[model samples]
Target chain A: MDRQLVFELPNDLGCIEGAVEFVLLRCEFCEEVSRRLRFNFRVSLAEALANAMLYGNGGDPAKRVRVEVTVESSALQARITDQGSGFDPDRVPDPTAPEQLHRPCGRGIFLMRQLMDEVHYNDQGNAVTLVLRFQDTEALLREASA
Target chain B: MAFQVSREGDVLVVDVDGQLIVGNRQELKTRVLEELEKGEQKFLVDFSSTGYIDSSGLGVLVSLSKKIREQGGELRLSSLNEDLRTLFELTKLDSLFRIHDSREEGLQGF
Candidate 1:
């Protein structure tokens, strides 16, 4: 069975905690997700939520950030969208560059890409989808028995 | 998120608990800066209880690092679990800060 959750949050950073809590609570209901994978998903989702609230919505309290999450037996998917004008993710500087290492502007996108198995942006750049896949535990147990 | 600060001689040990994400990162920054203003030079952030951190949290740490250096102070980190350690590695921030396995080791460095 597949389960889904949707959240509509304001651009204010105050709502970030609630958003994270919601995702984590849903993860508890997903018995297929391992603890390690849940941790990874939580971190990635937090980054994405920050980006949506700060950059995508320009931190405007009036704007709304929409989040949709789906949990399956082997994967979890999250789509986050904002109301403001979008910017290109490609233009974000490499935070690891020698000259840029100390700069803090670009690490969010880098962490999102590194932590999630798949990351895709809409053509408008205001929305992003992150996916994480895990190995089937049942298959692993069967293989062990075989 | 909450922070508890204690002094071990000249070193100020900051114990941070909960997720260090965007909303509460400013609190961490403010607390550290306030301590820095009080003539404390050596600092250690103990993350043994920290479960998660986002880029904003990392940025706050970097900002604090630079601020401490400007004041001729040193900042060290200790007790990062596997996930946070991997985050530092992925961002290549592991090389920029001195990371220790225990609070005693971190305090020893400063």
Candidate 2:
């Protein structure tokens, strides 16, 4: 199945949950991946959504967050775009910094990298795309159907 | 995060359970600060049963830590699982606060 859904939501941090649920709904519809894949998908998608809401809009509620999901033969691609001027994704501090451990924030990208098969960003840095494989799509479909 | 509080001598131990994400951030912030304002400065956050927390939750912890330190007291965390501890270490927050293996160790501070 090949399809895409684009959403323009206010850049409020609260919208992250709704975006995650939206992805989950798609996974349920695909019915082709396993519980592990589902968890991985949720975590990766949540990180992208969080980035869109936090940095994309500068945490401004008035801005807009755009998300698009495309399902393909071999992979699932999700793109999250935000309203701000964009940023340098390369500069995100490594959460593993020895001096930064107790601080409590700034690990979304780290977790996202750990969960998704591959993660990349567009030149402008305002849009991030996450790719997931369909290695066990048949099993996912059967499991979801049953 | 939903919290249940109890006092042990001069310390106020807050048992925060549930997902501490952006959605519940405000509640956690308000409640923790409220407890501190009521003169319960020495604090311990027991996450023994808490399973998840996001950046926003971390933000609250930072804010409270600053507030508590400003009041000439301290904030300690206890019972952090592997994942939660990873999050802390990843952000390098492990160096900022005092962490203990158990509630007793955190409370006694001896």
Candidate 3:
């Protein structure tokens, strides 16, 4: 399956769920891959969008978030771009550190990296791409159909 | 996430349903903080019905756990499914909060 969906979300955090749901509906995969995709993609996308809105755009509802999702034969890629002066993602400290464990913020990027197969940021740091790879897609398709 | 609250002895038990993410995490934080302000001590967050939670949701939980501890209260989590459990484990937050396999287990010594 090769399909792409592009949409824009306002910098409102409330829009994350709706946008994720929209992408999930358009994704096509075998049963097992679909199940994992739902959970992984939902969490990863929500984290990515939150980072874009809260940090990249500084929670400015006036800014727009551009989302472009592509479903490949064996993976799904989502790119989220925001309008703001980006911060260095490398500077984000690990949330699990003993000192930072109690801190309420700074976990979104960490969670994205954990859930997505690949996480990338543009040089400007205003945009991010999260990729999820399917496991044994050919075998899973046969199993699903049988 | 939507919640059902009840009192199990001195512990305030909250049953969360639906997804917990950035949008409504503050609501959960506010509700618990309100309870903390009212002098309620022990707390249990039951997530059997919760399907998913993003980083923001987990962050709120961490913040609440800290605040409750400062109030000399306790916080426990119960009934996280496999996916949620992995999230906690992956983030190494499983060590930060007291998690029980069942609500009964959580409420036993609370």
TM-scores for chain B, listed for all candidates:
0.96, 0.93, 0.97
Q: Which wins on lDDT, candidate 1 or candidate 2?
A: 1
Q: What is the lDDT of candidate 1?
A: 0.85
lDDT of 1 by residue, A31-113 (tens): 55555455667777878888888888888888999999888767788999999789899988889998988976579888878
**What tens digits encode model 2's per-residue C-alpha lDDT throughout B1-110?**
38888888889888878667777778877887888788877999989978776766776888789888999879999899877786677566777779898999999852
TM-score of each: 0.91, 0.73, 0.92
Model 3 stretches with alpha carbons more than 4 Å out: A30-32, A135-146
Winner by lDDT: 3
The sequence of per-residue lDDT tens digits that candidate 3 reaches over residues B22-101 is: 78888888998999999999999999999998888898899999999999999999999999998899888899999999
Per-residue CA lDDT of model 3 for A53-133, tens digit only, reads: 988899897999999998776778999999999878999999889898888888888888877789999999999999878
Compare the candidates by TM-score and give the number of the best one.
Answer: 3
Give lDDT: candidate 1, residue B1.
Answer: 42
Better of 1 and 2 by DockQ: 1
Cα misplacement distance, residue B92 of candidate 3 (Å)? 0.9
Task: Name the better of 2 and 3 by lDDT.
Answer: 3
Winner on DockQ between 1 and 3 is 3
**Candidates sorted by DockQ, best first:** 3, 1, 2
Off by over 4 Å in 2: A1-5, A29-40, A60-62, A72-74, A98-105, A133-146, B48-51, B69-72, B79-83, B92-110
